[model samples]
Target: MSQTRSDLRTIQPSARIALLSDIHGTSSDLDLSRLRARRLQQAIEAINGECPDAVLVAGDLTENGDREDLAGIRTRLDLLNAPWYAVPGNHDVGPKAGIADDQPTSIGTAAYEEVMGPSCYTATVGPVRITGLNTSLLGSGLPEESAQWRTVERDAEPLPGPFRILLLHYPLFADHEREEAGSYWSLDPEPRQRLMAAILRADHHLIVSGHLHRPFVREWRGRALIGAPAIAFGLPPNDRSVGWMRLTVGGDGRVTAEERPLAVADEVR
Candidate 1:
């Protein structure tokens, strides 16, 4: 038994995965949407140039969760030739702590599903398995306002694969692990702990997340954790340029992630 392919297509056992997160629905964090869109376009072209089998977005597709952000995001994503996957961040879902005037995150789960496919789903690329989970909960103890959890859980079972990957909006560990503020709001810490247990139990290669709008990577418990920066906004105090991550998964199933900035001069949307 050669044991080659997986569920979706022929399992080649290795594939390149370009990871993008926290776009925030704008062309750029700078002014003038023209150059910003151009930089974003350039980044996508570069990713495709690497011959990756697929692209992944961890979350925060729009700024302020506005409907218009979809337009810019769609434009950038359309330029990609390979298949891609994405989920909503806290911003795209409206107010994270509910509305200022008592509004909810909206039960438009179906709408998100239709617009960007399933809110929480799984995709098989050759021998690698990529699964996206929705971590933006409405209430403190809630899972999501929808059944997206069931979908992710159903498809999240570990497969005997070359690489197992999980795409989530929130960091898996507790926010207290890093900073005091809720910078990692996308990760409902409680549910994430459970999800982390599941992934560790299954022995995955890595878990990727965004929403902090800062690119970071670390390894723990034999799991590689990767996070991408905001493609639209820069962090407070305006230190360095914002960027995305390019992941190269080798034939031996090892992955190397690089975070590159979309630094085009005077660009913003």
Candidate 2:
């Protein structure tokens, strides 16, 4: 029997995971309603057409803790047709941040969990252990949330696998300065440095994040750390449109992704 083009392609293991991050209420931004649908359909088609097993929303699933924002994210993501998981971003919380919310602040965990299910948790797929870290604890004015990284790092016990991938909203290591981390709502050097050390010490294969909103791919020694472009809106210092990533996690555990802008008419060839 001659195999169809799709059939000839290897379905990424039931262990494969589709990652999404930093959506931040872009669900209704401009023509994003249609673009979002198409981007998601492309991803689903990649998963179903190539047939991956699961999808994971890394973080920043909403712009704010607005019910409408969160609900919209959940609805679009539900179309993936597989067991899905998510972590929370700074915007997922109502506002108070590091503290629990009572009046629905904007950057707290409780608000995110209300819609996304849980702010921080773990899901295992095949021999892989995907740990979703909540870096949003370190919000716009809060560095104390950096402590949460300790909890996740400490609780990240040894996993009996060839790869351990940590997914989060903020990049622990970024192309930013120590004094600049606070301004950008990113992890300070100490927290980020420690987190990177912990991940490396634990022998993780990859660490992925999206809060930076810029797209970058770099490898330390041989390990890869990816910064994904936000699907909601592109980052500052540039005029690019919104984009999403297609990550191919290899069997030998090398990770690669291409950030494709959504509103552009020129497609990936």
Which candidate has the top score in TM-score?
1
lDDT of 2 by residue, 93-190 (tens): 63323344444333356656676765666667765667776775544244535545655677556554545667777676566435444435456666
Local distance difference test values of all predictions, in order = 0.64, 0.60
Cα deviation at 79, candidate 2, in Å, is: 1.0
Off by over 4 Å in 1: 1-12, 27-32, 95-103, 108-110, 138-146, 174-186, 267-269
Candidate 2 regions exceeding 4 Å error are 1-15, 26-48, 94-107, 138-151, 176-181, 260-269
Candidate 1 lDDT over 1-269, as tens digits, reads 01112123223456778888776555344453554466567778877787678888878776555445565677679889888888777666643442242334545444455566667766777767777766665234344544655555565566665477888777765334433334435444445565666776555677888877777677666567777776666565364567777876666555678776776565333
Q: What is the alpha-carbon RMSD of candidate 1 to the true structure?
A: 5.8
**Over the full model, what C-alpha lDDT does candidate 2 score relative to the true structure?**
0.60
Best by lDDT: 1
Clashes of each: 6, 12
